[model samples]
Target: MARTVRFHEIGGPEVMRLEDLETGEPGPGEVRIRVEAIGVNRAEALFRSGEYIEPVKRLPARLGAEAAGVVEAVGPGVSGFAKGQPVSSVPAFSQNDYGVYAERAIVPAAALLRRPDGVDAVSGAAVWMPYLTAYGALVEVGGMRAGDVVALNAASSGVGLAAIHTANRVGATPIAVTRTRAKRERLLEEGAAEVIVSDEEDVPVRLLALTGGRGAEYAFDAVAGPGVTDLARAVAPGGTLLLYGALSGRPTPYPGFDLGMPALNVRTYTVLETTRDPGRLRRAEAFVVSGLRAGVFRAVVDRLFPLEDVVGAHRHMESGARFGKIVVTVTG
Candidate 1:
């Protein structure tokens, strides 16, 4: 039997429960992995709370889309991966369809990628969603380029830090924004050219000056609140403001007002848009793997919890007190 985390209701962290289930063989084009590390993402929390893009259609739903472990067996019609292969899920499918927060999981073989050398199960479980989300927003959709300047809001989150690393990879400059000054210095030390304490600094004023009178070409925001007004103002003429999340729990109030002024483009960006496309997915995978092999991309683990501590892990992610990825290690 494999221990799995499943939620029978849509509410707080308490809704989750750990249970044992009989392990099954992989089906055609599928691979069964004995999970070693599970990544804790905000998406799961939102999904459990029934606030995600697609509402939870059923109950007793499993949660998680990223994990790293050894491939115990491969199903027919699958190639390239065999028994004892180290691999990780790429978040290419819905969590409802393929949740990896279990001691073992049956995942589509196409969604698996070999763990890059030097990246252990802990860090391997941490990279997929964060890096891919940043890549989709900055490169695939935003068309970020060399020397381009980007403003990253909620700069202390995993995606925020991944944006910092992605920007560095393409020779772009990143301005990290946090709600307070507590994470400013730490963000700088992690490759941000500049840091903005959103509560203390004028985003537009500082951004314009930092870019030498020209605002950032890309404003990657995870906070979709009233501050978006300033973020819109902080974009260069015809620049793009890509909003990805609404952690503030407040409605965004900017595009309607900033419609005509700077002629900016405000749009919603999601990792799914990129991961679902084959070409873009391949590009993202290659880029991230190359960066990891080159030691340019890094997965910073804030904390690791045993599978039994799933509730506390979810609580920590919701508390906004973490600086990097939270991982849950599984033992069977």
Candidate 2:
């Protein structure tokens, strides 16, 4: 029997339940993995509450997007992967359904990536969503280049931290924005060229000061709403402002005149758009894996909870108290 977390209704964290499920053999081009660690993402929370654009289709839905595990069985048509091999999978909504949060999951072979020698299960599980999102935004969409100045908000979150690391790796200067003064030092230690506390300091003023009044070449904003105006003010002329997430639960407000005056490119970006091309997905996976192998990218795991404690994990994530990725450990 496989143990899994499932939810029957759309509600708060309390709605989740742990249940016993049966596992079956993989079909052609599929592989069965004994899950070790699962990443807890904000998307899962939104999905549970039925707030995301894509609605949950049925009751008793399994909630998870990514996980790391060891292969237990490989289907007949699958090659190059053997049973007992360590692997990580990107189980997006369109690919696999209702299985990643379980003790074992059957996923398509194309979704699996070999876990590099130096990477552990916990880190491997944490790396997929945030790194891929960051890579797609910064390198692919924003066109961040050497010597460019990049500003990132929510700089302590998993995606924000990944952006900082990616910026540094590409020789771009990263300016991190956070709401807490306590996270400043740590943000800088994590490769941010400078840290801006949005509550204490005037973000646009500090950004202008840092860039010698020229402003940043690109701004990656996770917090939407009026905060986007501040990001717009800090963008250099002709720079791109890539709006990725709405952490503030409000729509990004753009001043009508500002868009025309500076000729700035303001666009909403999502990982799905950038990674839609097969080549881009391959390049993104290769880039992130290479960074992990070379030690340039480090997965910051704040805490781990048992699979049954998922409600607590979701609450912790909602509180925004964690500095890095929160994970759920599944044991057989």
Best lDDT goes to which candidate?
1
* Model 2 per-residue lDDT tens digits across residues 187-272: 98999999999889999999999999999999998888877877788899888888888888876677437556676888887766
- Full-model lDDT for every candidate: 0.89, 0.85
Model 1 residue runs over 4 Å out of place are: 254-256
Task: Indicate the worst ten consecutive residues by lDDT in candidate 2.
Answer: 90-99
Model 1: lowest-lDDT 10 consecutive positions: 254-263
Best by TM-score: 1
- How would you encode candidate 1's per-residue C-alpha lDDT over 191-302 as one tens digit per residue? 9999988789888898998998888999998988887887888788888999999987888886746546667888998888877787988899988988888888889889
